[model samples]
Target chain A: DQQVKQNSPSLSVQEGRISILNCDYTNSMFDYFLWYKKYPAEGPTFLISISSIKDKNEDGRFTVFLNKSAKHLSLHIVPSQPGDSAVYFCAASGGYGNKLVFGAGTILRVKS
Target chain B: EPEVTQTPSHQVTQMGQEVILRCVPISNHLYFYWYRQILGQKVEFLVSFYNNEISEKSEIFDDQFSVERPDGSNFTLKIRSTKLEDSAMYFCASTVQSEKLFFGSGTQLSVL
Candidate 1:
């Protein structure tokens, strides 16, 4: 079963606009959430992360907001640039061991 | 900045042949993990290793699959008697603490 899900397969937005990607999880035990961006033929690079204790986390142009009661999270990029056109994956993990459950990924296309 | 790296960007192997995929995680990271993604699918966790031993593994990690740190710098995954269903992109990741994972470019294995 897919514990983490990203229902949107693709999204398109104009440059300088806000781009939002959403994710949901069924497991309440997951205490950490992360977002990664991937380009074709390249590894996923760390974008931002949020702890269960906090409802939101922001880094540069990327912000992640988590809603524990709804088991939902989202990543928002402000002033989206063409370089932000890539697949974004949402991942969740519980305590220590370091195994992550990843979403199917959302392909974002920022048109210039 | 250090990043995880994998060798043999692409490999084509005959069914039933054994194959080995190698990875070198960040130098100072202490935890290691392996995940795989079939085309059009989400990334799935396979195993996690720490202190030279496997800490946890998913059901997908069967007898045919094995992981080893071999030496200080190299982490490898070996598949014995590979099957066509095993063909996928395998990623190696590492983390120093928390849930932030740095993933490698991945080795795309094709079993014919």
Candidate 2:
């Protein structure tokens, strides 16, 4: 149940700064990692994902970096906006199963 | 743009009552899953259904819990006997072939 860990309970960033949210996994077998954003009373929404075969994936203002050796992944949101403020969750799953183990969410507050 | 939808955004039930949470997965997605999160806790996988049968389930999904894709579009989770610990937000997700999932807003089940 503790396979995925997000050590930070919360993170604060300036609107125009880069916000980096990190996640670590104890299970090396996990090959797929995903970042999700959740607002109050809403379910986690998929933001980005990276496969083990690749080290980096980017989508517009968001980029995800994966380190296979260290078993870590991080999400970087550049020029963060106030609308980007939400609880961010990191999830990991591998192989054929769709079962994702999630880390304790980190509340990201982008200050305007 | 197709998104999963859940009914009865909030449900309140007495202890030991039977409560059913409903969800409508994305039209073209072939895999379905159920995950729940307690207040201030990480989301936990409950079960996954495919081909009209359960493909995998977590330990938290005991005999008291059951999932059924009663029709082509609707997936439902039934908890035979609710307990105090069953109060949480239940999310229904679907995917085509990857761990990237489209999740519903969630059903806030309050077991009193």
Candidate 3:
């Protein structure tokens, strides 16, 4: 079963606009959530993360908001740039181990 | 900046052949993991290794799959008698007791 899901397969936004990608999880035990950005033929790189206790975390232009009650989280990029065009994956881990459950990923295309 | 490194970026093997994918995690990281993504699918966890042992493994990590950290710096995944469905991009990741993971560029394995 897919514990983490990114409903949107792809998204398109104009450069300089805000781009939002959403994620949902079914397991409430997950305490840590992370986002990773991936380019074609490249490994995923860390973007940002939020703890179960925190509702939001921001790094540079990227922001992640988590809602525990809804079992949902989102990543928002302000002033999206062409370089922001990539697949974004949402991953979560529970209390026990280091195994991370990943979402299907959302492809973001920031058009210039 | 420390980064995970993987060797043999791409490997093409016969269906019944064996293939080994190698990875060198970041120097000081304590936890290591192997994940794979079939083309157009979400990244799926294969196994998590800590202290030279497997902590947890997914169902996909069946009898044919084995992981080893034979040396201080090298971690390898061996697939015995590969199948066509085993073709995917394998990523090795490491973290130092933190929620964020650093992933390698990945080794794309293709079984013909």
Candidate 4:
């Protein structure tokens, strides 16, 4: 299903720069949005999340911004490091976190 | 530091064979889920289990797919009959009625 989409297949950024990954969702029933980071052989690790009631949430170097009206959300990482080079996925929760629809994921390459 | 754990990181099976993927969700987590990602595809939800029963499932999770929590520590997904298209990385996740989903390392199933 095309309920959630990450149009960018990949992103490249330099160290000490900001890397933004964008996502869009057509489903309005979703209430929670999250970003997960995945290394080559590991499962996705939760980075940050935003509730529909809030516009932004931040933790450490990661921040998530939600624009309900625009049906979009973005993950911003400040001072990107080479260790952050991995696939980032955007997922949306539809029913109290019971079911999640994920985007195609964007590969972020951070160069030092 | 608790984490979801999955076994048999990779499995190769012939078409029509039955394969069971195993996972151990984080201790005390009440919700369990299975999601799969085919090569170059989005992560699609397969099913969600709560209170020892399936609460939700996706279209891709046809009759051939089943989930069970045989014990307090084990969650398993069984494919009654494998197909070539079933080849993908299957991730098991768990949460406690929240947005943060702790995912397992994933099992790479190759159906030949």
TM-score of chain B alone in model 2: 0.98
TM-score of only chain B in every candidate structure: 0.98, 0.98, 0.98, 0.98
lDDT (0-100) at residue B59 of candidate 1? Answer: 97
- Which residue runs does candidate 1 get wrong by more than 4 Å? none
Task: Assess the local accuracy of residue B83 in candidate 3 as a C-alpha lDDT between 0 and 100.
Answer: 98
Question: Compared with the true structure, what per-residue lDDT tens digits does model 2 show for residues A1-112?
Answer: 5999999999999999999999999998899999999999998999999999999999999999999999999999998999999999999997645688899999999999
Tens-place lDDT per residue, model 2, B1-112, is 8999998899999999999999999998889999999998889999999889999999999999999998799999999999999999999999887788889999999999
Stretches of candidate 3 off by over 4 Å are none
Candidate 4 is graded, for docking, as medium
**Ten-residue region with minimum lDDT total, candidate 2 chain B:** B94-103
TM-score of each: 0.97, 0.98, 0.98, 0.97
Question: For candidate 1, lDDT tens digit of each residue in A3-110?
Answer: 999999999999999999999999999999999998877778889999999999998999999999999999999989999999999999996566888999999999
Return model 2's CA RMSD, one decimal: 0.9
Better of 2 and 4 by lDDT: 2
All candidates: CA RMSD (Å) = 1.0, 0.9, 0.9, 1.1
* Clash pairs detected, candidate 1: none
Taken in order, the candidates have interface RMSDs of: 1.2, 1.2, 1.6, 1.3
